[model samples]
Target: MKRISAVIVNWNDKETLARCIRSLQQQTHGDIEIIVSDNASSDGSQAMVKEQFHETFLIENPDNLGFGTAVNRGFERASGDYLIFLNNDLEFAPDSFAILVDALESVPGIGAVIPKILYSQKQNAINSLGVNIHCTGIAYPRMLDEPDCDDLAPEEVACGGIFMMRREVYEELGGFDEDLFLYHEDHDLSWRIRLAGWRLLTNPRAVFHHRYHFNKGKMKYYHSEKNRLHLLLKYLELKSLVLLAPPLLLVELAQWAHSLMHGWFFLKLKSYGDLLDLLPRILVKRRRLQSRRAVADREIARLFSSDLQISGVQSLALDFFLNPLLKAYWLWIRRYL
Candidate 1:
């Protein structure tokens, strides 16, 4: 049996980290090593891991170094055939690791496998199955709140968080981009993985529960908006970027308008404000990313779905006037339309 190394990055969430560790201990896959990389968390996270789960490896960093950097630090210490990047706020089903491993091994071309993730609060709801990109370089969770089942089947995509990767692929393509402080790092990694001629899959047989802290507010919105723009500037081909420019600009304008109307003017301001502050850095990163482009424009184009569209008015109005009806409409669209 191939050994699997599980790397969980934690920062101040001791309770969630404990639950995650318990789930790791219960994994059916016995040939596994667990590593907890704590980013100088002041909330006793390091102490709790050291005192409670001494058998598991722990890396206590001297200071907070952001998510991607901490994961890269953990990857250096891992010694397994496969590496599993798990969130601290997640708990896996007993066979989660085994099932993901089985799927990746069965499909020789697959570089990464993501398990079906359901929301812990809403038992029947999903967190994410896989991730997909639209033509404009916007990416979203494929199946966000659907029931967990084997119905989706195995499919390929750009990437999925809470996924496992072969050790060889990790070494070849390199680990997570450290510059990405938080959001869009997984998407960036997935895009690179696909460009390197490896596939990503989602295995429904493996299950996990996620605590979707929907009320995270502005911090979430900031990272999401900033990293999204950074990703487009980094990997998207110039031709595709030009084609997507109009819709992208429209989306940004709509977002700013909505934020202003909803009393989130500061939130909108910070997103663009940060974008300007980071523009020089973004340009430097973009140059580096373009230099390493092994995959052609056509190959990258195949990863996106042309049918996806983002209408500003419809999206903004639906949240205010008809959420339930809109939910039903989406269900119908996803089911039959």
Candidate 2:
């Protein structure tokens, strides 16, 4: 039996971390190791873990390293053949780890697996079954707030908040891009995984309950918008990028207009500014990734979903008009890819 390690990243969310730890401890898989990577949380979470769950390996960082970095740090000390990266605010079903591990081992080419995630407050409703990306680089959670279903197919991106991957896969991929820090880290990593010809599957037999609520946070907007553009520049082949330029520009305009109305115009502008600053470094990394890509851009483009599934933010024009147009555009340009 392959041992599994759960690396839970936390920052000031002590109570939620406790619940997450308890759930992990309840896993039916006895060889599972629990690793708590605290990001310099001031909420006395370190002491709580040391006193209450001292058996669990704990890494108390001196400063608040970002989410991906902290998880990577915890993983450095992990001793299991399989690794589960997770947020602090989640509860795993008793058999979740078992189900995920079984799926990973049973599949031949799968690189990672994420369980169906349901909303903690509304357990009957689905939170995510991993993430999906649009051709324009927009990534959103699949099945957000929708009724739970048993569609256990493969996905474009594993939900970064919680998922299991083999130790070799994690190490080979070089772990999460620390620059992503919070948002879209999963999309970036999963995209690379797909580019390397590894399929990602979501196993319905396992479930994770997440305490998630959507809010229009400024910092959230910052990283999400910036990292998305970064992905476009880094992953998409130049030919594909040129072909998609018009729609991409239109999306930017729409975002600018939407941001102006919603009090986030500066953030929209700032994301572009930040993208410019990071361009040279990003393109260098792009060359590295592009050279390693085993899958063609056109083949990979098929993984992108046509439907737009942004959560919590609603707009009449967006819902009724823009989405269909974008879908049409994707359908048309995708043939070219």
Candidate 3:
């Protein structure tokens, strides 16, 4: 039996942590170990886990270290053949871990395998089947709102946050990039895994329910914009970057304008400004990432689909502006390209 370590990162989510752990305890797979990394939550999250789940390996950080760093800490302590980085707000089905373990073990070259994630609030709705990226390096969960629970075959990517992977691969790729702080680290790792010639997969038979958002605010948007650009600079070659620039610029401009219209001007400015502020760091990291590149541009481009490319910009425009502007922008992209 292969030993698996499930690493769950927690912030101030005291309310959801118990349920998450309960679901883990119910896993039929007995060879699993639970590692909880707490980010110095003031809300007694650490105490609750310590008092209740004695089997869980708890790593307490003195300060609120970001998600990427916390998970990396967990990786250092994980002693399993397989490592699973899961969110604190997610509840796994009884066989979720077993199925993921089976998938990774069954496939020879697969570096990682993710299960179908459903919404905890809307049980029928899907959270992520598989993650897809665009030429611009924007990544999103495929089939975000889709209801179908069909089984999906193994496919390739670089890294996924809620996925299982061989411990060797995690060490070889150097684990998640702590610089990411919170968002887009998964994409960065996944991209690196693919470039290193390892396959990342999704197993539909395994399932987990995610709370999705126990907290809501502009912080998410800020981290999102900051991280998206970070990954783009870190992964894409100059040629692909040049090709993707126009669409990305257009999308950013539309987002800025929409933010102003919605009286979120400061939030919009902050998002772009965060990117600018970290420009030096991003460039330095990009050079470092490029040095480790194994896969070529042709291989990376094959991972993206045409529909995925258009949909990202389309969704952004629709979310910020009205539906009419989205249609117009979509039409413009179609005509110009």
The superposed Cα distance between candidate 3 and the true structure at residue 217, in angstroms, equals: 1.8
Clash pairs, model 3 backbone: 158-190, 159-190
Candidate 1 vs candidate 3: the TM-score winner is 3
TM-score of each: 0.86, 0.96, 0.87
lDDT of 1 by residue, 126-242 (tens): 878888676545566777766766577877776687789999988987798877788878888888887777888888888888887754465666677777887787777676666
Task: List model 3 lDDT by residue over 46-145, tens digit each.
Answer: 9998899999989999887888899999989999999988888899889989999898888888888888889988958988877777554556787787
Off by over 4 Å in 2: 149-161
Candidate 3: deviation at residue 195, Å?
1.5
Q: Which candidate number maximizes TM-score?
A: 2
What are the clash counts of all predictions, listed in order? 0, 0, 2
